[model samples]
Target: MLTPKQARFVEEYLIDMNATRAAIRAGYSEKTANQQGPRLLEHAEIAAAIDAAKGARSERARIDALWVLQRLVFEAEADLADLFGDNGELLPVEAWPLIWRQGLVQGVEVLELFEGYGADRVHIGRLRKIKLDSRVKRIELIGKHIGVNAFRENVHHTGLDALGDRLERALKRNH
Candidate 1:
């Protein structure tokens, strides 16, 4: 798991921009992108992990990216409070209930909407922790995913649909 700083550095450099600028944006000192980035990048495994983690996943399934990213940051800094008990999941205790409740709501919605589709425990579990942002970002990133066509396109409807669809599906699944 790469730290947020490390993730930021890679995401930027991968943009094909100047290395120094990318490094500075990542909060490194004095043209350190060359020295810092390459060293971190050398952890090829970490790079692959970040790539897989950073791919275009839905906001319904990825809103927690920042949470996970922060967790990774905590792991990197070795500063996570022992709040999640001995289980080693790096989330705060107080936030879990609220988060899980939201996740349940999302799962029900998904199951309902995907009525013809089957949603097992594991799949729902994975989908539940997906951040609210995951859905939102799926809409936003659609433009970034496609190159020139992105500029020509805009997506106001995706947001509306995610909300309505998720809710409608949840209600249907309840029955």
Candidate 2:
């Protein structure tokens, strides 16, 4: 069984994977958190708890690198114009698809004016904006995932040829 402090530490670590910060959030002394955090991770019980928490979080969110890549590369695109009405009113949230709707809005200010008056109430509400992810960037990331050197526009060679070159260099240095 893990101690209360250790359990808290595991919970905090999963937030952003910063050991020192987790220790501090788990009620450890700030002065000692830096050291205590890593030490807690070394404990068997604490480590298992962290792994279990990570697994549970993954299962709940169903999010992985592949899911992210697919969302970035293959998901449907949304336009800001489609999300708003011509009268400067935001359309219903249901208009947006599930995935695109998450970040599909940016709130803006709409100032109303009364005739012959200084000003009316300022309305604060959601405004639609183009939030499309860059297709080029997504494609580049996919390229990197498949071992393509995006910078040089070529594939990275880490096979026998690279090893043979290193061996030749070492042989020359030994001579």
Candidate 3:
């Protein structure tokens, strides 16, 4: 069981996961909130409460590690070809597949083309640009989560290899 202030702190902490801010919002003195926040978290009851709250939130939102991984995989596999029609023109948003509409596209820019200037201008076709989230970045994130080094540049040589070569040359010279 927690006091009202402690319960308030738990609720406030859930808002942003910032202890100091939660402490202040929970009515702790600003001068001591910085210390009080972490101190409160150290209590077993508080920690358990926080865990319960997080679990409940995740359950309500239907989000977990598996859901996150699935979303990342979808983003990484999203194809731009799906956004175009048979004639190579971009398809309307309504025509896009649900996966592309939901996750792949970051934004859409439509620039209305016109003929002439000012009052003499006549309406023309519009230019549509679709901004896609970076597939490479999504793959990288998925790789990191799964412990795969997709984007990491690995150098295979250990410094000991060079040292061993130098030692071998020195021994040959002495022999």
Among these predicted structures, which one has the highest lDDT?
3
Report the error of model 3 at residue 75, Å: 1.7
Question: How would you encode candidate 2's per-residue C-alpha lDDT over 67-162 as one tens digit per residue?
Answer: 876765554344546666788666666765565566434333444443443475455444444445455665677777666775446557668898
Error of 3 at 18 (Å): 1.2
Model 3 alpha-carbon drift over 4 Å, by segment: 117-124, 149-175
- Residue-wise lDDT of candidate 1 within 46-125, one digit each (tens)? 57854664464334466555665553333333322332456755354355444344332232222212323445423322
TM-score of 2: 0.50
| Rank order (by TM-score, best first) | 3, 2, 1
**lDDT: worst 10-residue window of model 3:** 149-158
The model with the greater TM-score, 2 or 3, is 3
Q: Give per-candidate clash totals.
A: 12, 0, 0
lDDT per model, in order? Answer: 0.52, 0.73, 0.92
Per-model C-alpha RMSD: 24.3, 8.2, 9.1
Name the runs in model 1 displaced over 4 angstroms. 17-20, 53-175
